[model samples]
Target: MHSLRNTRLPFKVSLSLLSLSLILPIQTSGLLFKPLTLPPSHPLSLQSYQPLTSATTTTTITTNNTTPSPLTLSTNMTLFYPAETAPHKATILGFPSTHAVPRDLLNQTRNEIMDLAVVISEFEPVRVHVRPEDESLARRILNERFQKLEDINNNNNNNNNNRTKKAKAKRFNLLNRRTRDNNSKEDDIPQYHLDRITFHPCPTNHPWVRDTAPVYVLDKSNPAHRIAIDFGFCEWGGKNLREINVRNEPLGLEADGEDERSPVSSRKGYAAPDNRHWENARFAKRVLEREFDLDEQAENNEIKVERVVSPLRLEGGALEVDGEGTFLATESSIICPHRNPSSSLTTREAIESHLRALLGVTKIIWFPGRKGLDITDCHVDGEVKFIEPGLVVQNKPHPKTGKAEMEIYKEIKEILGRETDAQGRKIRVVELEAADPDLVGWGGDYDEGGEEELEKEQEEAAGTYVNFYFVNGGLIVPAFGDQKRDRKAVETLRGLISPERKIRQVYVSALPLMGGVVHCVTQQVI
Candidate 1:
């Protein structure tokens, strides 16, 4: 046995060196050698080569080829969903900015539910990472600070924060000590303090990042290629009344602008401007170019980001795909004058063509959506989502207050019954009730000039949980603290997803004031 072990040493060492040579820029000639040979034992042959059960043996060999090659980690393979099945990988969520609610309310919603880790597991067994607005802000702040320091050194000491502080100190020293003390005693008077830390002003309050962000899709024909769909985003057609509503502002613009203007000591930094739909589309095209190795001529093959022009302007929040070829959208969102004013195709044909061209959708299920009742104009995601192909979970009307909603639901059923996809298949529809009727409209706040006016407005705008966000691994649904209703909604969602996926219920008291719920405020990237 010892002699046999010696025979194999040369071959084993050569194999190891070969493996290392492939990874490193190393020569393999020195590691190769003539094969070793071992003679059979004469005693073993006499004993008929009987194996000893209690024999303990160990062998050691030394060779020049000792180090192993570094392991190469492969990029994740992209998975394609059938458009009829539940998504098998990452789910993208767009968070609305501005008047959808206050920062505390948004943070509370994020903290209480929306477990990102679980969402990613349902599609692919991995953790989903969240890219929030704060990341963009932090990057902007650091850039500005560096620019300020550079300017101060160049000018021999004239930076905004330092100059402002010196001016304040000079004025304070000139005043009588008693008078200065008295001035400081005026606590009610607001004193502007220069923040040494530079910050990027928050972008417009249109937190619907999902709509503005590009939707990523994998090509069925080429698994290695990905397509990013840049759906046009509008400011909910100018329906929101919140101060945060700045039409067409894109993320990261504020930071960029601040950095550019920081060197000019006399120039005041301005808030970030909105990015137009065309701009976002261009940005999406560029992202695909960098991330995927797509070439300009790749449109014919390989990978390409092609913009699908639509007569009907739609945001990501207004549509939901069922992994299968089928999708759900509302007529109100597609047909409203606010979106498509002079389109030739009557609402139905326009929708059909857009879905086919952009998503390769063969079938579409339409539902009756409320017009002039919400800011989305009538997005279906606020009402329904496909849990599986041929299966849907729809938001239903409350028993006492949903008379109009119920009627609309019936109309939707009839439309769905007659509608077929490009493949000529009928769609199946299911109706779900709102979790709590009493808890409806619980978190809505609007400015009304003064405290008295604000109080009057609160009496009018209540919120609903029907508008929620489906994040990567969890459902960020709204809750009004109507324990009975909130719990029911949670249970309903849990039953829809596998037990491994968690349902997070975020109380969105502030969203209603912006004229919608979680669904309206968010867009999902495919």
Candidate 2:
């Protein structure tokens, strides 16, 4: 169990004195004595009292550099989140665990997982805990989720609810079948069954854990301290083709005329597929508990993990903070019309408020982002990161290829130059060129269904290197196999990081097909 203690001490200040009598020049003043007619005092009352005066005055002085002989302050520390200096803490990762990716990609992801596990274990004992839907908490969350889904279904159903008897029967049968299947699974599945995996059964199935997972932060003033910031995530703000994008096509949908089953009907369908969200949450909880060394009985049996929810929907990928007080973010994702249409907070206001409340931060440095582009609009991490206080590493636009994006980069540089932190410290921006542009097709297909479809496809096809993830002791930078640019990127990052931190490259060829990269797939918990 964690223990607490206190200490106390005293300090003294030095004093100096000088005599005014010795420093002043001699002066003579008239001395006169006058006695008015008064009654004579008795011998006992005639004693004289002298007035008090000081020729010398003492001055007490304090210096900023003066070292106090003894001082006391409580120091409480924990290794819950791995320090950048420490090589042992495993970097938590949120992968694009989509089933649509090629089988080889899955194998590679598995390998990467094992590699990360080994690295973390070498530093300290590691436990891989997947998130499980807490049945106790399920009722509340499920009720809320079901309400939302029902609203959407009802809205879509519109006035069809009061249709003729025959039509009502058909709809009833379909609804009844779905309901029965769901009920059976719920009854058969044991709450405590360790083997069972559950998915977040929300209709907005953009279950990308990295985009939605809570960002954990430690409170410097408190002992046994940690907090989770839930960043709001959208479905990449509707970048991919809603229906035709094969990579993004929902699971359980089969060919036109096959014996395909709805996910609701399959035992392993939805549960096994979207387990990443639950897994991440569970892993995060365990890490916090173990790191703080809380009393097992009290923490496990009594105290629940406390969370501070930020209404401002921010994904960790969109935010990059220096270990210090400053954070870097872009205006695009935070303020995009696509993410929050009715939000009262503007881009600047939302950022300032969010930083102050969530990060205990006073200032947020913003760069005018590439707007009206792909998903996430433009996450700040794709543009710049705070490598250290007052210093940044930015993704430079390619001079020859990204002509338009280069203009955006120039604007970003200008903005960064004018901005300062809350402490009035100027930010130093560094530039690194973006990866080479690939020949991407609209939704990875040559044909466009219509003029509107063509425009949408073009927007989704733009390739970006800004979406990169920084892993534990390494950077999982995305590479599109453009040899020249890829090599330069690797070299640029290696120069900034230490030799101990490996620069591992992950080739995400399939990202452009759906319109994002590695950073989109992972969110870092600070």
Candidate 3:
């Protein structure tokens, strides 16, 4: 832990980002999302980790000679879904728009998003998807706030927040592109400018792309040719918590034919899926159209990067892949009537078969997630993270966690500790305890939300530290201003991961109101 290093901002960058955006032949303006409109921040050229390449991981996932079809609507293509720890070519984030985010939560959401985008840009190229309308605001925030001290070289160790007028002003040392003043004396600069944060034109109903974006995969022989699997994002279930939809069935799921619980979201309230929600559902297809030329590629003899629409109504966050033929998911999110209404995908075995064909998943691990618990219907991503095939990271039950929620955390750990992976190896589960009650607004008077917010947040956000997202050479973990716990998480993760990987923490405030953190908002490219 003592040898652990924090993420260091690169001193210089190049115009390659500008060149990448300019040189590429983009699509016509008539389309909904014409390719990227801005240059990425810079490439996170990590010396320890290889830069984005077609080379796959050393670990191999073996399958029979027969190629499997994930769904009835199929090409006999076998897709390989990589683990989160895999090196990223680029990272994506959807900008907060007035049409998507609630007015009350918009500012907070945008601020958090901007902060996240800036931090992630340090590790990899960030492709931010902005609504055509929010592009101006996007530019304004990036230039005005993130581009601080561009003309001046402030290499001083003054990286602390300054409190004034009872409102602490956070000084984000988001050193803009080495595309800055040439007068800076810093000599150790990044070899390339791959870590650029550029804005692209793509509207999303929600800023959470983990649910809306395509689940990327690759063909084993040619890894460069990426495949986008559109699981048909249905606003977590084609129904929102603010809507009038209720269920008479008991969550439509069970674990080992055990406890059957009712849908918690129905008892609360519901919000009907609006136009924006539907737009999010279709966003993956839009992204595919904008980024790849499937028709042209198919006609060619070269590696064809294509996409497919899976009848399984799923979100990226709902499913977890271990690169090695194992998949972890929850029944509430995938097996529910709302997400899988089609009779073809009704049973657990049927859904598992689809997963096997779609992602080359040989083993399927199912958890009984609580439906109507939150917008995502208890996505498995909120529960566990597979660090590797046999190794995992899970959250310890928070001190203030309720009985039901605590049981979930305990149950997950119990299963992980005992269960063997697809490789026939005993699982290694590491526990990451969350921040204190006082620090995380368990009962204290936090400025963000009230008692109701706290209660909701506690249930859904039980082990958020586990939700930290992985980048090329580092992970963007959430910070709740808890000095002890947050630091512990960083140190623990640093110890478990490769020494080359850095640990960077960002103060997250607004996302908890919606029961998500950094991982909820970001997605990695193949």
Best of the candidates, TM-score: 3
lDDT of all predictions: 0.38, 0.38, 0.56
When summed lDDT is taken over every stretch of 10 residues in candidate 1, the lowest stretch is: 15-24
Error of 3 at 98 (Å): 2.1
Instruction: Specify the poorest-scoring 10-residue window by lDDT in model 2.
Output: 1-10
lDDT of 3 by residue, 76-188 (tens): 33568889988886788888765445455566568678777766776788878887877989877766545433212233233333323112222122212221123233442
For each of the candidates, the C-alpha root-mean-square deviation to the true structure, in angstroms, is 27.4, 27.5, 15.0
Compose the digit string of candidate 2's lDDT tens values, residues 44-73.
010111122323231111111111121111
What TM-score against the true fold does each predicted structure earn? Answer: 0.52, 0.52, 0.70
Q: Report lDDT (Cα) of residue 32, candidate 1.
A: 18
Ranking the candidates on TM-score from highest down gives 3, 2, 1
On lDDT, the stronger of 1 and 3 is 3
The segments of candidate 2 whose C-alpha lies over 4 angstroms from its true place after superposition are 1-90, 94-207, 236-241, 244-304, 341-343, 400-403, 422-425, 439-467
- Rank list by lDDT: 3, 2, 1
